[model samples]
Target: MGWLAAGADHEVRLDAGRVVARNRQGRVLRSVPKAVRETEAYLELRQLHEWLVRHETACREQVEQWLVRSLPVPTALIVEVWADEAWRAPLRDLVVMPVDDAGRWDTDRAGLLRDADVDKGLGVVDLDGETGRLTSTQIVLPHPVRLPDLTDLREFATDLGVKQGTRQLFREVWTRPDDADARRRELTRYAAAHYRELRHLQARATAAGYRVQGGTATVKIWEDGVPVVASVWIGEGDPAWETETGPLGFTDPAGGPVRPDDVGPVAWSEGMRMAAALHAGRVIAEDEESA
Candidate 1:
């Protein structure tokens, strides 16, 4: 048998009654007998695997945070990180925008990164659905925060045959319908069992940048300098077990009810996103009986 996988910059192989590690030059670095469960070589290999897993997770988490917050990332910073294989793996094939010297996203210069070239700069598929090279000194990784813009970007990327390895956080969000009266009615009676406990849901909502109050989750957005607040009732339940959620409610800064039609698109989308997320954690009827 030959090496089946590569890990921590070394080739790993299961040999005759042992595990073997080899360097890039095919030189045997270490071997661990199958009977030995805690040899130095085995421990080192385990540590390497653990480190690699943590590195991968850290890279993805950092990138995801940037996307969720719609933060502007410098092109130079990305290019610098691309030099490392661990960081590059998560960033490959993501949509990136070139930033002009003025520190603004130049949509005209945006493209899907095919490769990060140290010498020639980035190889990309531009908005025109054509392959091109972007040699700009600075670029911005725009978060897919704008729903309409994200849709157009996906369509453009599709035309160029660009496929991303990681999830696009700023993708378009789906809502049930635009009918205010119908949506209000649905929300009034909405109740779903969450897979997570009430406390867990509340904590998650708070960590996601929402306000947690009296066992309810609230998100506030400003429209034209007026505060638009949306809140969902998260019922109290055992902290360690799944719980059910209560109805969702929306109100203005004055504590007055705001109709769905009166809510701006941004606020509406964010409010629904919170509701849908909590709803997704619902404990199914079939699972309840099993438990």
Candidate 2:
């Protein structure tokens, strides 16, 4: 039988071989008859919940990649994705800019997209601190390019009480430790004593969007218009099934060592983050024993 109304504010369904009753908030009111738990409705609900979890994870990962790479996205694509309930939740209320047909972005056209309408197009709150609908045919998801007038834009956004749906691009970044010795010590503190297999470490680094080369994991970032590369040495394993990691290194585009004080904040933090992640993945002797 289908779900039956047991009370004005409760519902009963056979779920996982049990007859369960729940309130509007999905709180369990009661459960009985273990046989009802295998009902189709119960199984369907469980499957839907699992699918939603995966969908949400996918959405967040995709969006984060765009933010990290500062890649440009098309407005129509955003509108298309917004139609899906699963995608809409993560994308709704994000700051967007309408690109002109000539491939130019005017910060004046930038606004928080409140809603997507089939007939009227996008509802946006513009930079002038005005709320209106924009029917532009095309727009671009701008790269997090540093702008000269960003301070004024931030103040305007603050006045309008705008909260970005995603991480802000070109946000003010912090500086890291200036002392090379101190920075080196901090970076290597998490080095694993036991070697992690080279293949395993490579897989982890690749999955994390880092370049794995010659037994090292490298992350590249731009600092002060200069390219800096941070590398962690995940060495080739020995015949006895052991591998080792060396100290973290930072270098400039010209392959010269960069002092910690010279590294930009974003590069420093990202480089350290990569090192920590690799360290965490190290296969310690204790972990092997526990396994």
**Cα RMSD (angstroms) for every candidate in the order listed:** 7.7, 9.0
Query: Which one is best on TM-score?
Result: 1
Error of 1 at 254 (Å): 19
lDDT of 2 by residue, 1-291 (tens): 456555455566655544566766868755532443454555565576577678878987676545444335665666678777666765665556665677566667677677777677778876676888767776544334333355666777677676665555334333366677777687676565345456777777789878987767898775544679988887754434566666777998677998777776667766777877777777656656798
Q: Against the true structure, what is each candidate's TM-score? A: 0.61, 0.54
Query: Once superposed on the true structure, which residue ranges of model 2 sit more than 4 Å away at CA?
Result: 1-20, 23-27, 30-34, 143-149, 153-161, 169-291
Candidate 1: residue 182 Cα off by (Å): 10
Q: What are the per-residue Cα lDDT tens digits for candidate 1 across 151-236?
A: 77777766666556556733445344577677776565445646456677777777766787766788876543467887887766
Worst 10 residues of 1 by lDDT: 32-41
lDDT (Cα) of model 1:
0.66
Worst 10 residues of 2 by lDDT: 139-148
